[model samples]
Target: MIERSVRGEAVWIRLDRPAKMNALHLDGWRELYGELDRASEEARVAVITGTEEAFCAGDDIETLDAMESADDVSELAVELRRVLFGIEELPVPVIAAVNGLAYGGGCEIVAASDLAVAVEDATFALPETRIGAYPPYAVERMAELVGKKRSMELALTGEPIDAETALEWGLVNRVVPRSELTDAVSAFVDDVVRSPKESIRLTKRHALAGKPSTGDEDRIAGALARASLSEECRDATQTFLEGGGSEEE
Candidate 1:
């Protein structure tokens, strides 16, 4: 589900599960974490992208259904959070090249990255609440990026915002035509790499230093575990996998 390649100092990690709109399963997340860890060792920067049609759709619902208990679900959530935190803690910059639909965890990936560039038509949303789950990491970081009210609106309503709206909300650094996305991201990467590596890392560290702590990860994890065990969420997830209902419904 991940395709890795190296060009110059950049390690590109592509999510390649087009059959599932690039949604990640548990194995996929583990693979991604391993890839990112390797990138931190060997590369000066990492760029994550999706296949031609999607950046990512989100977590694989089928895998979620396979979890036998809330602890199983908690383990999954904690591991995913660890991977995201790994990306954030990487000494080098991690850029997200969002090409298409970035929903749920997909959106969270962009939010977690140091920088992001998106295609004009790409859509972003945090739709976990629609399935009776909440993205705890997203809830923790999004408010700092987009302010509390906007974050609340996005999380509570589970509505998608377009690329323009995403930019306005500070979710993406740049939005370009689909054909120009590669060039745009490349230019951005070029600009980032031109600066002194240590200075850039220090700058990133300082910029992220003010991110507030909520002390709610464990609480949110428990809630997600509980939600996963809910009959409503189970039914909603099955329906979602079957392509039966909108998040709003």
Candidate 2:
């Protein structure tokens, strides 16, 4: 589940499903979209974090396995795209306070955020390829932050990168001790809110002005649908479900 709270001028959103490593299902995505909407209206800055030890493991594996067709996959992709794009289009800056592991879609969330702060022990990865699926948003947008070579390395290898490495690659702005993660994020929020809200909003708007159009969302979603419905994806997901591999979730 996604939880939201107000803290003066900032809104805090927590990914709260430790048992599944904070993996989100469709309802979670919808709730997150609603929370982002609320944040846009009510706060000058927003922060996304995780409860317990995980930032988010990714989309729930069981939910992915349950999809019976490409349309089912496409539906979930569209819903996810709404939240990811919503993060990008939000009037105020969004900060990802990554507390622990951020894998697959979770990493995508970090990429989409305006800024990110991660704990020293936090790990990030786009391991979707291991299960025969792919990270739609990460593939398309991560290069803007981390460069094409780094992004390709992540998506192609399906390997996890530590917080220090993530910072070096420009995936996150700061890396602090676990105990200091909240304070670090608070400091960033303070810095952001120090500016006039309209100035901050306009700065973000102008920064995004010449960015590539995301009209390829549908095309990307279609590719994801094909990947998710392939026999390779089904077989790999089943193997993982049957204890053939070990991961955060």
Candidate 3:
């Protein structure tokens, strides 16, 4: 579910499940957290990207639909927070190298990363509402990055914005042609690692200090559990899995 390698002063983590457009299940999320943990120990910078035409499509709808109890939903929410918060608390900067679509939880990952670079063809959205669900982590993170109004526009509308629009909204740092993506990411990595490692760590810590807290995971998990078990979500998910509804976000 994840591929990790050390490239010079950076560690590159790639999502490897192209068959599902790299959508993550529980095991995949756990694997990602392990990679991030390893990156903190091994590299000065970390870059996350996906294979082929996808960066990540987000959590697997099948997994979400199969969540049978409040405990399952709560565990999912807790694990999601661990990964997202792990990115923030890591000693080195984490860069999301977006190659294609980023939707739902995928978009939340972009928002949580310290910085991001994207191919010109990449797209982003918080389309959970279309499935009668919502992204637990993205609400506060998107509001922090793009403000409440714009964030609401995304979460409520379930529409995708282009790479250029993401840049304009402050979700990504740079957008380049697909061919230039590797070089673009390498350039950022080089610039970041040139600074002393401790300084970089301290800078990230100080920067995060200014951000508003989103409270505890319990509240977030409860909201998701309620939504996931709702009649609307169950009906929407069933329709989607049967291929009779819109594409899974």
Candidate 4:
């Protein structure tokens, strides 16, 4: 469901599944993690949005329900850890253009994003409890974005929050009309693209300067939350060469 396009140094990654409301399948999760990693290292900025109507309605409940594999839950959880983390671990900023409903996993993705712009009518929720599963990923990310109490309310209640409420609760960076979402995100990404690559990369590293220590070893993979940065690190070295090497810095 990922459609990729590059506008200058900013890459636009869109979730192209309006009919299924962008419900994420396992393949979608892997692809998203892989491509977002590519954009984070190769492009100056990464902007993701939904196609046509919805940013996402979260997981494809139907497909998930039909699956009968014995190890499905474990396998899904493993991939989910990577997918949610792909957004969080990007050294360059990852922006979410929440044009519509960001339910369940969609909300989790938004919570993991570095910055987010939601449309006026956008809604967010974690309704997994209503469906019989726990939103362990969404809960952790949402609690980090908002707070534990509020996130608990949303998670436990399975109620959707409007864009204004989400913004007030600090779930979203800004809210604009649906008409303005595309242009607004584009303009902002353009500004980001104009910035020096290292400035953007350094900004991300500085923001994530210190990793939060989680006592649970199984639940949290602090040190291995992300793999070693081979591409972005190499790209930085090339940028040094493009200038006067050590003399320029």
Tell me the alpha-carbon RMSD of every candidate. 2.2, 1.4, 1.3, 14.7
Clashing pairs in 1: none
Model 4 misplaced regions, further than 4 Å: 209-249
Give the distance in Å from residue 92's predicted Cα in candidate 1 to where it truly belongs: 0.8
Off-target runs (Cα >4 Å) in candidate 1 are: 214-217, 243-249
Higher-lDDT candidate of 2 and 4: 2
TM-score per candidate, in order?
0.93, 0.96, 0.96, 0.81
Q: Against the unseen true structure, what C-alpha lDDT does each candidate score?
A: 0.83, 0.88, 0.88, 0.72
Ranking by TM-score: 3, 2, 1, 4
Residue-level lDDT for 216 in candidate 3: 68
| Residue-wise C-alpha lDDT for candidate 4, range 1-249, written one tens digit per residue | 889998877788899877777878778877888888898778877888888768877666655554444355445566677777656657777889998888888888888788899999998888765544556566556676788999999989888899999999998888999889978787777777687878777887776557564223345332212211234423443453455421110
Worst 10 residues of 1 by lDDT: 240-249
Judged by lDDT relative to the true structure, which candidate is superior, 1 or 3?
A: 3
Q: lDDT of candidate 4 vs native? A: 0.72
TM-score of 2: 0.96
